[model samples]
Structures are given as C-alpha cells and as structure tokens.
Target: MSLPVLTHCPYCSLQCGMTVAARAEDDGGGWEVEGANFPTNRGGLCEKGRSSAELLAHPDRLTTPLVRDSRREPFREATWDEALDRVATALRDTQQRYGADAAGLFGGGGMTNEKAYQAGKFVRVALRSASIDYNGRFCMSSAAAAATKAFGVDRGMPFPLADIARADTVLLVGSNPGDTMPPAMRWFAAGRERGATHLVVDPRYTASAAAADVHLQPVPGTDLALANGLLHLAIKHRLVDTAYVAERTTGWDAVRRAMRQYWPDRVERITGVPVRVMERAVRLLAESRATMILSGRGAEQHAHGSDTALAWINLALALGLPGRPYSGWATMTGQGNGQGGREHGQKADQLPGYRMLADPAARAHVAAVWGVDPDELPRPGVSAYEMLDRLGTDGGVRALMVMASNVVVSAPRADHVRERLGALDLLVVSDLFLSETAALADVVLPCTQWAEEEGTMTNVEGRVLRRRRAVEAPDGVRSDLDVLADLAGRLGRGQYFSADPQTVFDELRRASAGGKADYAGISWARIEAERGVFWPCPDEDHPGTPRMFRGAGEGAERSSTRGYFATPDGRARFHVVHHREPAETPDGEYPYRLTTGRSRAHYQSGTQTRRTKALLDAEPEPVVEIHPDLAARLGVADGADVLLRSRRGRARMRARLASTIRADTVFAPFHWAGEQTINALTNPALDPASRMPEFKVCAVDITAAPAGEDTTA
Candidate 1:
C-alpha cells in the first residue's frame, strides 16, 4: 500500500494540515482525508476539510477544454493548442483594436502563491494591460488598509493563531470562529479553561457569540461607534496604558480628543447596545493581563470598513496590546491563501512583495528580474468592482480572463456584474468546474485541482506552506502554471514564464526580496523541515519572523525603537476615526437591513462545496434568516418562501425563523446562483480607503413570494 500524501485543505485560510490516502480496491476505491498535526488546527479539521477528498474525482470535474464562438453557442470540446490559440487571439485582437487596457485579468484569493505571482506577471509582461484585480478586494482589503495604517505593515495575524490560547481576554468583532474555522475553537476553549474572558461584538448571536462570556449585540454598520465607545470607557475609567502609548505610539492625543463625543450614552443611541454592556467590555479588556482583539469579514465588508477596523486597532493600541507575546489586534483572513495572494501581487495597486505598483524602485527591481524594462510595465489599474462595472464601456475593458474565482455568484450587485460580463468581447475562465462565471466564458480551460497540483500557500499567520500533489490529474487537465506558461508563449512572452512550481516560486522569492513581505530566506526544503516558515525572512541565516514589532535587540526585522514600525519614523500611528452610517440604510420604503455571509456547510460562491454530495445534503439551498419577531410581523412562517427586494435587484429564498438574529435585520448566505444569489440584492458602495463594497449592510424589504413562484430561476 502507498503511504498517505500530506497536504493542506483547499478551503478557508486556516489551511488545516491533512493527509489523503487511497483505500484498498477490495474496499471502496476512493480517497479519504485524515487530520494531521499542524499548528493551526492541531490535528483537527472541519466538515469541509473531511469531505474535501470528494472533489478529487467528482463526476462534474472538468476534464477537457471548452470553447464557443459566441455566448449563444454551446461549448465544444477542444485541444489545448486550439483553446490557448483562441484565447491569445482574442486578447491580442482586443488590445490591438481597443488598446492595452481593454484586456483585463481577474484573479482569486484562493490561488497558490506561484499562480498569483505568475498572474500578476502575465497581465503586466504579456498582456501589458493596466486592468487587473482579484476578488480579495471584497475580502481582506479593508483589514489590510487598517493594519497598514496602524502598524505600518499588514500580516493577517502578526503573531500566530496559537497565540489566542495564551491571551487572558479575547474580544472578537464580527468574527465567528465557531462556524467558520471550527478547529480554531479549541484555543478559545483552552483560554476559557484558564479563566480568560471571551467577548463578542456582532449583529447576530452566532455560534461563537453564544459561547462568549459577553456578547454585545450591536446594530448593523455601527462597529466604529461600538469600538469608540469602548475606548471612551477605557479613558474615563483610567484604563489607558499611558506609559506604553507615550513610548510606542503617536497621534493618541488627537484620537483621545476625538473620543470625547463618543460617550457611552451616545454610543448606545447609535449602536443599539446598552451603556452598561459597553462599560463591562472595557473593564474586561483593562483588567486582563493579556488581551487580544480580532475582526473578520463581517467587520471588514462594509462601506466604512477601514475606519471601523482602525477604531478597533486604536483600542488595542491604547491598551498596549500589540507586539506583546499573546496580545494584539489582527484580522481573520477568509480565503485559502488570501494573505499570500495579495502579498505576491495579482492585486490592482500592488506588485510582488507587497510593493506598490507606483513605486519606481519596486518596478525597477521586479523588471530586472522579469527581463523587461521598467517602462514596459503598465500603470496601476482600477479596483475589482470598478473593473467589473466598466466592462465593455468606452475606455473600459473589452476582454477579461478569470482564474480561480467565481465572481458571478460572489460579486456585489450580482445582476449588474452578470450583465457586464455578457457585454464583454471575450471572456476566458480557468477552473476545475463550470462555475457561474465560467458558464458565460467564451473559452473555459480545465485546470488541475488541489490534490493534483504542487505549489505553496500562505496561511493566516503569514507562514508559507507546501501543497504536494497526491494524485495524477486527468489526461485532459493541466495545472494553472502550465496553462499560464503556454499562454505566455503564445503571446510571445515565453522566456518570462515557467511551468515548474519551484521555478516560479524561486522567481517570486527574488522579486520579493528586500520588500515588506520578503521570502528571500524561505526555501522549499526549509518549509518541509520546519513545517512552515513565516515571512520577512531576509537571508538564509535569518530565522523567519513569527512575531513582529519587538523593541531593540530582539531581531533584525524587530529592530530598535526608531525602527519599531514600518513607517517613516518607526512609531505606530493612531487614526482619529469617527462613526458613520452605512452607504445604504433601512428607511420607510425598505425598513429592514440586509447582511450576507457564508454558511458553515459551504465556501465561497458554492463552486466546489455545493458539488460535494455530503455538503450539498447538509445545506440544500440558500435561505433568508430572519428573527422570529420580524417573521411574525411580516406574517411569514418557518420554511415559507419570501422575496427580498433592494435598489439593485431582488432574490427569492426560504424564510428561516432564527431568534439568533436581530429583529431589525435579515441575513442571507451568498452561495448560490440565478434568482437565489443574495449578492443580487447587495449594495456595491465602495469604501473610500479600501474600496470594499458594502456587502455587510444594505437596505431591503421582504414579502411572501407568490404561490408556486420559481425561486430557482
């Protein structure tokens, strides 16, 4: 019998380590997943991870390339050469006729570091297009902006996931680890065993909130006010770490003055949370020896997400939580490789190494490695939503190439994005299945799945890991790296692209050297020997950094006071932020607030999870979650069909009478397509700083659907 292959889960940022092994022929001839001892999960995995092996040989797995001359025509099976040639011809024709920026590239946060890096290079060096972005713009961009503004550098969790167990108090802002990263809940349990205070702030009483020592149920989009109110109480009760603030941070005085207007009573009026609850939260944070605060997509997927995240960071800074052994502020990255995907480029404004594309030094360094002149690289492009919103318009992208992401069911304003896609001159998609977006593509390329590819992915802690291939891909399928290399050769940029994972990663390390998210010291051999290595490791002799922002003499990356932070002066900056209502709020016409999120049974867009029989059985379809009081008021019964309408569009879903949700708000899971897509009713208002769409809050009204109305449309 062959030994089991070691790898990480393909869903979520936790990336739990697991092993896949083939069963004996006498038994069922299938593969099974078993949890492995890893730092993040500690030999534990969720239902998704356990059933992930089903995707390896699913019946719907794409095995051949598909192409069609027009959207109205049916897809025809084609050879790799024909498909690549067709895609290249469309990209070339679009660029030649409409200009370089007319051909755009859209990527995903779930892609491996090598794939993400190559995509960034392909768009710049091959297509020479200034229109490229990824779905991560909708996920972690807000937390990234906030962290960069506060700490000068952004890693999902600057310390590590295991640090949660060491903290004496944990405050979670809109983070639901119980339903999301179920394995990580062990740390919360461990902390509780030691008398740690667990506090949660959310609009819904989620699984994580239910287990918390205190749950602050605030109104939707009032996170900024809730954070500021906690700070107000901290200052009023003399809980501020004055000495630490004076020594390690700047701009606190301005922030302190800004909090004068955020008194407990005023915050209660805005957030619907009581003043006593706010005071208790502040006291718990102050009294604990070590405190940690973490935010999630619920907190970062709003129009004011950046400031809301910054306000939480300000509270942590005021309490002197960062840089401590077991205390700090961090964001829970959602996608499988969200941390590394953005770090190694494939983002709108960033080059490899987390360097801004507009930075001349970065451009020169990357250009030299890529064998191109700095001038050949295109300028920074528009963001994800803007790129989608401008498709086929004048001065906008005429052709788009998508990789790893299913944007049709996931993007904000689902109906509008679908329309823009339909208007494109050419649409190309590379995925393992015909996702909602792929169905509209002019060419659909079958790509290798996780178990059939070998690459690297960075986890939530910024540690880089190896994903080893366990099984052979179908005869007709190819790895994404191979596809990129072939496509680049067809585009006359053959010398710059490599199909080998190691080669691509080596180039990435060189391009990322001397930059913020440095990987110069990390090697594949080292990763195997050490399980995984953290980033900012500058040289072979340097130990990879797991914790950052220490004082002088700690390490090279963690240098003296003058270099404590990544900013110009090395001091952490405090953002003086104020609360603002969401871009769209409930009113007389639309009297209920709408929020969307993931269901534990499925991942993003339901691309893979929905295809798995076990998971599909767990959650058969999308449903609208409403409080019992709200359902009663609307004369809706449990399991009743309801239609929700927003300014953008409408969706029909089943009503779930859940008391865990607020009476004034309704929730929906955005993991379906067609009429059940919750994003169809979502607002696309972008955050000024992060450009994040207001997916967490919008105004909507719901009514019972007419009898026998087709909700599946």
Candidate 2:
C-alpha cells in the first residue's frame, strides 16, 4: 500500500494546514486525509474539515452532464459533445437576439484560484457577458472598497497573521475568530497574555466576547455609532495622534467636528453599548503599545458596510494605528480566495490587473490584453442584488449562468431573488451536486469536487497554496475550468482556451503582469519544488512571501508606515445613528430577532457537509439556539421541536436553550435547506450603502413544539 500524503483542510478561510496521510485505498486506489499544521491553520481542522473525506467521496457527487430541453422539463443525461453544442448554441442565439448585456455570469470564490481566474477570462472573451459578479461580493465587498479607497490598492492585511501575536492590543469589531477560525484566536490569546486588552464589539455575545476584557454589545446595525463613540473618546481624551493626522492623511477637521456633534452619552442613546463601556474600549485601544483593529463580515454585511469600514479606518488614523507594527485594518475574509477572486477581475466593474472598468487606463490595458475593441467590451453592470432585481426585465438580463454558487440560499430577500431568478429564460448551473440553485437551473453540468482536482487557492490572509489532488474523480465529473474550456471551444473561442489547468493558470498569471498581484514568481513547478509560497513573489530568484507586507526578508522594507487613515473626511465618521430596529423587526406575530451564522459542526449551507455521515451524526437536524429566558417564556426546552416564523417565511427545528444568544434574539445556522433552512425565514433587505443583505439580523417569532412531536427531554 502506498503511504498517505499530508495536506491542508478544505473548509473555512483559515485553510488550516493538514497532512492527509495517504494510505492505499481498499478499492485499489491511493487516497488519504489526516491533519498536519501548515503554518496558517496550525495543524487543525474543524468538524467539517475532518469529515471532508465523506464530502469528496460521496456516492451522489455528480459524474455526468445533464441538460434540460425546455423550461420545466427534466434534465436528461447527455454526452459531453452534446452539452457543449447546446451551450454554444444558446450563447450565440442569446447574443444575436439580445446583445451581450442580456446574458450574465456569476463567479464563485470557492473554486480554485486557477478556475476562478480562467472563468473570468472565459466569460468576457468567449461569452461576452458584461453582467458578472462573484459570491465573494456578499462577504468582503465593503472591506475591499474601503481598502482600495485608502491604499490605492487592495490587500487583505498590510502585515501578516503572525504579526498579531506581537500586538499589545487587538480591537475586534463584528468579527468572531474563535468559532470561524479557532487557530487565528491565538493572536488575541497571545495579546491578552502580553497585558494587551481585548475589546470585542458585537450585538451578539460570542466566544470572542467571553475572552475579551470588555464586550460592547451594541444594538444590531449600530457599528457606526460604536466606532464614532471610540473616535469621540480618543479626541476628547487627547489620544488623537496629531503627527499621524498631519503627515499621513487628509479631511480630519470635518470628521472631528462632526464627531463633536455626538458624545458617548449621546452616542449611547442610539447604539446599545453603554456610555462607560464605550469609553473603556476607547481608552484600552489608545493606551496599548501596539493596537490592531480587525474587521470581518459583521461590519461588512450591512448596506452601510463601506461607511462602517471607513469609520473603522477613520478611528485607526485618529488613534495612529495605521502603518504601525501590528496596527491597521485587518479584515478577516470569509471565503477561500475571496481576495484573489476579486483581484482577477471577475467583478462586473473591474478588469484584469486590479483595474476598474471605468478607468480609461485600466480599460485600455485589459482591452489590449484580450485583443478586443474597447467599445466591444460592454459598459459595467449593476451589483449582484440589482442584477437579481433586473432579472428578466427590459435590459434583457433574462439568462443567467451560475458557476459554483447556490444563490437561492445565499442571496438576501431570498423569496424575491427566487422570483427574479425564475424570470430567467435560461439558468445554467455548473456544480458538484443538484444544489438548491441547481434545482432551479435548466442545465446542471456536473463539475469536479475539490479532492478530485489539482489547482491553487488563496486563503483569507492572502497566503497562496496548492490544492493537491488526492483521488480520481467520479465517472463523468469534470473540473469547472474544463467545462468552460470545452464550451469555449464549441463556441469558436478555442484559440484562448486549453484543457490543461497549468496552461489556463499561466494565461491568468500573464494577465496580471506580475506587478500588484504578481504571481509571475509563483508556479506549479515552484510549488512542487518548495511547499508553497505567498503571492506577489515577482521573479524566479525571489522566494514566496509567507506573511503580508512587513517587507519580504533581508533588506526588505517594512510595509511603508506613515499612519495613513482610510476615511474621506480625514476623521472617522461616527455615525450617530439612532436606535433603529432590525430590517424585519419582530412585530406582534414574530417576537424573536433571528440571527444567523455558522455552527461548530458544519460549513455554510450544509451543501458540502451534509453529505458526510460522521458530520451528520454529530449534529443531524437544524436546531435553534435561544436564550434561557426566551426559552422559559415560550415553554420550549432543549431539543424541543419548534417552529420559526418570520415576515418572509417560516422554518421548523429543534430548540437548544443557551445563554449565548441575547434574550430578544435566536440563532440559526444557515446550513440546512427545505424545511429547516434558515434562509427560508431570513429577511433579504440590503444595507443601502453596502448592498449587503441583513443576514446578521432578521426578526422572527418562535413557538412551542406541537404535542407528540419529538422534544428530547
């Protein structure tokens, strides 16, 4: 029997390094999975990661292409040739009938970096679709927007993950590393031990809150108020770094004066955080030796996400956190390669080389690369939510091709999104299973699962790694890139296409030109030679970058420091927002505020984890987490079957009483679909500025279990 090979865990952004010690397959094949820490994950995998083998080897994984003849018709198994011809024919027909803008393509961040890179190119060159966005839009768009506005370039962190350990203080707002990336918790833990204060700001009390010296439980959607409160304290206490403000930034006076309009007591009236707690948080942050203000989906998932992030940056600048040792904006991205995916120009408003579509220079560079007339490239399209709203409307956005996403579960105001998607004349899905979105597609093309393919992926903190193949793919399953290439060939765009993933990857790298996102220094060959290197490695002589900018190595300069803050008014805008209820506040009908998030045992939406027997056994059905007080009021005991009803929809599940959730709110993991899926009851109202749906907060009503229903005593 051949020995098992070591590898990394596939679930979550931490990308916890692991060794999948290979053993000879009983079926006479070689495959393996075990844990080996690869620096990022520190040699650990969550429950979902350990059971990934089940998901990879699941018997039901799609192995063949299936295409539907007409609307409402069942998909019939078809040969690969037939599938490609149909796709090509559709593309041509749609372009001829409605122009390029009529059709749209949405990319996925979960795909390997190579697949994601190629998919962006294929969409523009082969299909000529101007309306395209990625699932990453829903996760980190706010932070990305803020970073680009501040740095003139977008980077996840100016420093690296390991740098957090040296920080004297860590200010985390709307981020929970303990549950999502447990290993990342080491940074906070190390900071706490070094006499550093840990301040947690969230509406919900999380594991992160438990460890923090102070937990500022502001009301939901009040991050701006909380942030402004901090800036107010900093200025009031003379903690404002005048040197940093004068030399490194602009627009301070307007923001400072505006902040003066709202003090802690006034801000406390709007945000739920007490005035004293807000002051303490501000004092703790300002007094620390080195402080880092970290951000994540919590702050970014709102409509005002960009403003919220900018507010954080403003506070950082006012307090001199920017460009310091371990002080600056640290956004914890949720998806693997979410940062990389955006860098590759899959965004509707962007082009290759991290250039905006609207920029003449950026447009020309990309146009030159693709060998197309600038006019032939359509103007930028709307955001993902707007795309859904415009689905099947006057602009001819009637056809949608979803690659590696389950929009039905992920999109907000899911019912409206479903209606919008239903308007599509053609809905094509390329994925591993008959996903919830796949169920809506006219064509469901089976694609390769993670372990069945070889590619590269970039994690949350900007570390690039290789996705090594461990097993043979099931019967007819193919990689998403291969599917795209095949369709491109049939569509007469074969000149730019190739089946070898390495070739596709090379083209993607060439598109980057080795500058901002230089992968020119990275290659499959280099990865095989060494373990794997961080990107922006520009040349062959250069070794891969492990951590983000503190310079690379000897003679490398520290990521240029000047204490530049990333806010428009130079000062962090303290949104003195009043206490407004949630998007769908619990009315007379629904009494509980429904908060959704990940569970310790499963990944998002359960699309991958539900297939694992061990994972399923660990936590089978969906369960609602309610505070003990709320549970007592409702006469619902732990494990009691309960129904959850919201203004939009309803779901039923077992109730698990706990003190973790606030009394007014209940928690649900958004992994399940059908009856227990949290999306069924989630409100899809988006943040006005960020266009992010209110996945974090949706009010609902809960009820006791009907008699005879299973309620484990």
Candidate 3:
C-alpha cells in the first residue's frame, strides 16, 4: 500500500498540515484526508480543510480548455494549442495596437509562491507590461503598507502563533477567527486556559468577542479612535514604558500629541463604547505582564485603514510591546499566500523579495536574475481596483488575464466591475472551476487544483510550508506553471520560463536573496524535514528564525544577532493619525451601515469551497444578519427576505435577526454570486496610501421584501 502523502490544507493563511492517501479501488477514486499534527493547527482541521478534498472530484471542476471565437458567441471546447495561440495572439495584438501597458495580468493570493513568481515574471518579462496586480491588494495591502511605514518591514506575525498562549493579555481588534479560521480559535482557548484575559473590539459581538472576558463594541471604522483612546488612558494612568520607548522608538512626541485629542469622553461618543468600558479594557492591557495586539480585515478594510493600523501600532509602541517576548503587534492575513504573494512581485509596486520597484538598485538586482536590461522592465502600474476600473477604457488595459481569482464576486462595486469586464477587448481566466469570473472570460484554461500541485506557501506567521502533491490531476488539466511556460514560449520568452516548480523556486530564491523577504537558503527538502521554516534563512548552516526582534537585547543569544529591527536606525517609527468617518456614512436615505465578511464554511468568493457538497450543504445560501431591534423597526422578521440597497447597487438575502450586531449595522456573508453577493452593495473608495477599497463599511438601507415576493430570484 502507498503511504499517505503529507501536505498542507489549501485554505486560509493557517496552512494546517494534513495527510492524503489515494484509495485502492478498481475505479480511480478520490483521496482520503486526515489531520497531520503540525504547529499551526495542531492536528485539528476546520470544515473547509476537512472537505477540501471534495473539490478535486467535483462535478463542476473544469477539465478542458474553453474558447469563444467571437464576443457574441458561446464558449466551446478547444485544444490547448488553440487556446494558447489565441491568448498569445490577443495579448500581442493588444500591446501592438495600444502599448505595453495595454496588456494586464491579475493574480490571486491563493496561488503558490512558484505560480505567483511565474505570473509576475510572465507579465513584466514576456508581455513587457506593468499592468499587473493581484486580489491580495484587496485583502491586506493596508496592513502591509502600515507595517512597512512603522516597522520598515512587513511580516504578518513577528512572533510564532504559540506566543499567543504565553501572553498575559491579548487585545484583538476587528478579527473573528472563530468564523473565519476556526482552527485558530484554539490558540485563544489555550490563552484563556493559561489565565490570560482576552479583550475584543468590534462593532458586532462576534464569536471571539462572546468568548472574551471584555468585549468593547465600538462603531465600525472608528478603530483608530478607539485605539488612540486606549493609548490616552494608558498615558493618563502613567502605564507606559518610558525607558523602552526612549530606547527603541522614534517620533514619539508626534504620536503623543496626536493621541491627546482622543480623550475618553470624546472617544466614547465617537466609538459608541462607554468610557468606563474603555478604561477597563485599557487597564487590563496596561496592567498585564505581556500584551499582544492583533488586527485583521475589519480594521484594515476602510478608507483610513493604513492610519487605523498605524494607530494600533502606535499603541503597541507606547506600551513597549514590539520587540518584547510574547508581546507585539501583527496583522492577521486572511489569504493562504497573502504574505508570499506580495513578497514575490504580484503587487504593482513590488519586486521579488519585497523590494520596491521604484528603487533602481532593487530593479537592477531582479533584472539581472531575469536576464533582462534594468530599463526593459516596465514601470509600476496602478493598484488592483484601479486596474479593474481601467479595463477597456482609453489609455487603459485592453487585455486581461486572470488566474485563481473570482473578481466578479469579490471586487467592490462588483456590478460595475462586471460591466468593466464586459467592455474588455479580451479576457482570459485560468481556474479549476468555472467561477463567476471565469464564466465571463473569452478563454478559460483548465488548471490543476491544490492537491495535484506541489509548491510552497508562506503562512501568516512568515513560515514557509511545503504542500506536496497527493493525487493526479484530471486528464487535460495543466498546472499554472505549464500554462505560464507555454504562454512565455508563445511570447518569445521561453528561455526565462520553466515548467518545473523547483526551477521557478530556485530563481525566486536568487531574486529574493538579500531583500526584505529573503528565502535564499530555504528549500523543499528543508521545509519537509523541519515541518516548516521561518524566513530570513540566509545560509545553509543558519537555522531559520522562529521569532523576530530577538537577540537584539539583554540576555539574548549571540548566535542570531540581526538586531531589533530592519529600519535604517534600528528603531521603529510611530505614525501620528486621527480617526475619520468611513467613505460612506449613514444618512436618511441609507440609515444603516452595511458590512461584509466571511463565513466558516466558505472562503473568499466561494470559488472552490462552494463546489464541495458538504461545504455547500453547510452554508446553503447567503443571509443578512440584522439586529432584532432594527429588524423589528423595518418589519423584517427572522428568515424573511430583506432588500439591501446602497448607492452603488442592491442585493436581496434572507434576514437573520440577532442581537450580536449593532442596531444600526447589518452584516452579510460575501460568499454568494448574483443578487446574493454582498459586494454588489459595497463601496469602492480607495485608501490614499494603500489604495485598498473600503469593503468593510458602506451606507445602505434595508427594507422587507413585498409579501409573497421571490427575493432569491
């Protein structure tokens, strides 16, 4: 009998380890899944991870390339040669007719490091186009920008996940791992078991908040003010670490001045949290021996997302938490490869190794690795939202290639995005399933699923994990690497592209050798042997860095002497920020604020999970969670249809009356398509610094559907 193949779950940033074995039957059957005892999940699996195998043999899984001969024609099966030739010809024609920037590429955060690297390289080197970006721009770009500004480097977590259990107190801001990443809730449970206090700050009483010792229900998009208020109270009570601040930080005076205006009373009024409750929460964190501050999409998906994250980082700096053991500030990345995707050049302004594309030295280094002239690389293009907004417009991208993303269901103002997609001269999508986005493509290339691909993924902890292939891909399905190689060959850049994952990874290591997200010394064998390896592994003899910012202070070992930070002066910067209202605020026409988020059974856009029978059965359809008080006022009963309308668009879903959410707020799961998609009503206001859209908070109005109306239609 063949042994079970060890691999990581292909969902979420947790990258929970799992084992899969092929069944011995006369027919080619599906593989069996079992939990593998790895550090991130500790042998535990969530519903998404447990049922991930079902997607491999799903009925809707794409098995052949599809092509449309004309804009008005329906899609028909085509050979790989025909599809590749058509895609290559369209991209070439678009570039020749308009400019290099006329051709665009859109990638996804769920792609492996190798695939992402290849996709980025293919766009810049083969197509010679700067119009390249990925869905991660919408996922964690604000947090990444804020972290880079404050810490000089952006890593999802500077410490290990185990540190959560050792902390004396944890302040979770705008994150609910219970509903998003179920397996991660065990760390909080362990922390609670260790007598640690957990404080949750969110507009709604989420599952994590319900389990917390103190829940501070603040207004949506007021996270910055609430954080500043906590800092104000911490200063008022003289709970700050004065010496540590003086030694380890810069720009303290600005932060102090900025936080002074956020007094307890004013903050309470703005955040909708009582002053007493704020004080208690502040005291719990300030009095603890070690405190950790963690923020997520809720705090980083607004117009002021970067500033909001900076406020939280300022609080951590004031408390002397960063660089301290078991205490720090980190963003919880939502996508499986969100950390790695940004590191390996999928972002518009980034080169491999997280290097800035604007830097000549960085450009030269990467250009040398790709065997191209430094000037040959195209300049940085617009961000994700801007790229999508420019599709088919004059002086904009005329051709677009999407891989592993369901932008139709995930993009803000999704209806408008769909219209823009329709206007594109050419649209090519690669996926294992014909998602809403893929269905609109002029050509669809069938690609291998996660279980049939071997590559590495850097998780939220900055740990690089290996995902080994456990089963054979369906006949006629190809890996993204193969597609990229074929496309590169058609574009006359065949020598630079390789169909082998290891070859791409080798080049990625060289490209990323000395940059911020260095992976020069890591290998697949090392990852398998070590379960996973933390990055910054510069040499073969050097062990991976488990915890960052260590060995820079007293009582630390001398072997790892990389200092306390990656900043020029080895000190963290503190940004001074003030709170602002969301891009869209409630008014008479739109008296309620709408928020969109994930559910436990489905991930972003439900491209893969929705095809799994068990997962579909679990979360059969989308619904709007409305507070009972507001539901009563609107005549919306439990399980009744509610018409949610915003200035952008409207969606209809069943109402789920609950007291957990704020009376003025309505929550919807963004996992469905058509009229059920909450993104249809979301605002596309972008953050100035990060260009991240405000998908978290938007103004909307909800009304009960007319009696006997078919809302689901």
Evaluated against the true structure, the overall lDDT of model 3 is 0.90
TM-score of each: 0.99, 0.91, 0.98
Q: In model 2, which range of ten residues has the least summed lDDT? A: 558-567
Model 2 clash number: 20
User: Which residue pairs in model 1 clash with each other?
Assistant: none
- The sequence of per-residue lDDT tens digits that candidate 1 reaches over residues 1-713 is 35899999999999999998988877778798899998889889999999999999899999999999777799999999999999899999999999999998999999999999999999999988888999999999999999999888888898878889889999999889898889989999999998899999989999999989999998999999999999999999999999989988999999999999998889999999999899889999988899999999888899999999999999999999887668889999999999999998788889999898999999999999899999999999999999999999999999999999998998999899999999999999999999999999999999998888999999999999999999899899998889888989999998899999999999999999988899988999999999999988877787888888877664434832256777778888999999998999889989999989988999999999999989999999988999999999999999999999999999999999999999999999998888899999999999999899999999999999999887546
Q: Model 2: runs farther than 4 Å from truth?
A: 25-30, 70-73, 514-516, 525-532, 535-592, 705-713
Candidate 3 ranges beyond 4 A from true positions? 26-28, 551-563, 707-713
Compose the digit string of candidate 3's lDDT tens values, residues 129-189.
Answer: 9999999999999999999898888888887887899999999998899889888888989
Give the per-residue lDDT of model 2 (tens digit) for 332-409: 877766777777867777776576678777666666766777666666777777787788888857678888778887
Worst 10 residues of 3 by lDDT: 554-563
Order by TM-score, highest first: 1, 3, 2
